[model samples]
Target: MAYKISEDCISCGACESECPNQAISEGSSTYVINPDKCTECVGAHDSSKCAEVCPVDACQPDPARKETKEALLARYKKLHP
Candidate 1:
């Protein structure tokens, strides 16, 4: 599954630099994750780096955008390729 930033986000930008895939970007109000580029850090790290570093716990799995590990890996490949 891809990670998403919640309204709790303070826009501290702490999560932005933590995203290994560069999926997180500044939005009008908060940071937004590009689902097409998000792999939840699967291919790059053992866990989601954005969630790991977000102080407010704003980063969480997008319930509406679920995907299996296989699908995540495929997305990772597509982004890097």
Candidate 2:
């Protein structure tokens, strides 16, 4: 599943650079992840880099935008291919 930044985000900008796919961007009040671009770091890393670096643990899986590992890998391929 793709991860989404919650309101708990402090806008510290910690998660932005950690994202391997560059799927995250600054939103009106916080960072937002592009679901189409987010593969949960399936191809680029062992885990979700944004979640790994978020100090506030604001990065969480988007239930509404869930995907299987296979689907995530496919998305990663599409993004990097």
Candidate 3:
């Protein structure tokens, strides 16, 4: 699933450069995650780098867009290819 930045985001920009797919960008108030480009780091890292680097723990999985690991990997492949 894609990760979403909550209201808790500090606008730190830490997660901006951490996204391998360049899925993250600054929004009107906080950094936003583009679900179409988000693969949850399935093919890039063992874990989500944005969640790891976020100081306020604003990055969290989007439960509304649930998907399996294989699905995420497939998306990652298409994106990097």
lDDT of each: 0.89, 0.91, 0.95
lDDT of candidate model 3 versus the reference? 0.95
- Residue 23's lDDT within candidate 3 is 96
lDDT of 3 by residue, 1-81 (tens): 889999999899999999999999999999999999999989999999999999999999999999999999999999988
Model 1: per-residue Cα lDDT over 37-64, one tens digit each: 8998988899899998999999999999
- Considering summed lDDT, which 10 consecutive residues are worst modelled in model 3? 1-10
Q: Tell me the spans in candidate 1 whose CA falls farther than 4 Å from its real position.
A: none
Which pairs clash in model 2? none
What's the best-to-worst order under TM-score?
3, 2, 1
Taking all chains together, the TM-score of candidate 1 against the true structure is 0.94
Query: By lDDT, is 1 or 3 better?
Result: 3
RMSD list, candidates in order? 0.9, 0.8, 0.6
Winner of 1 and 3 under TM-score: 3
Best by lDDT: 3
Model 3, runs deviating above 4 Å: none
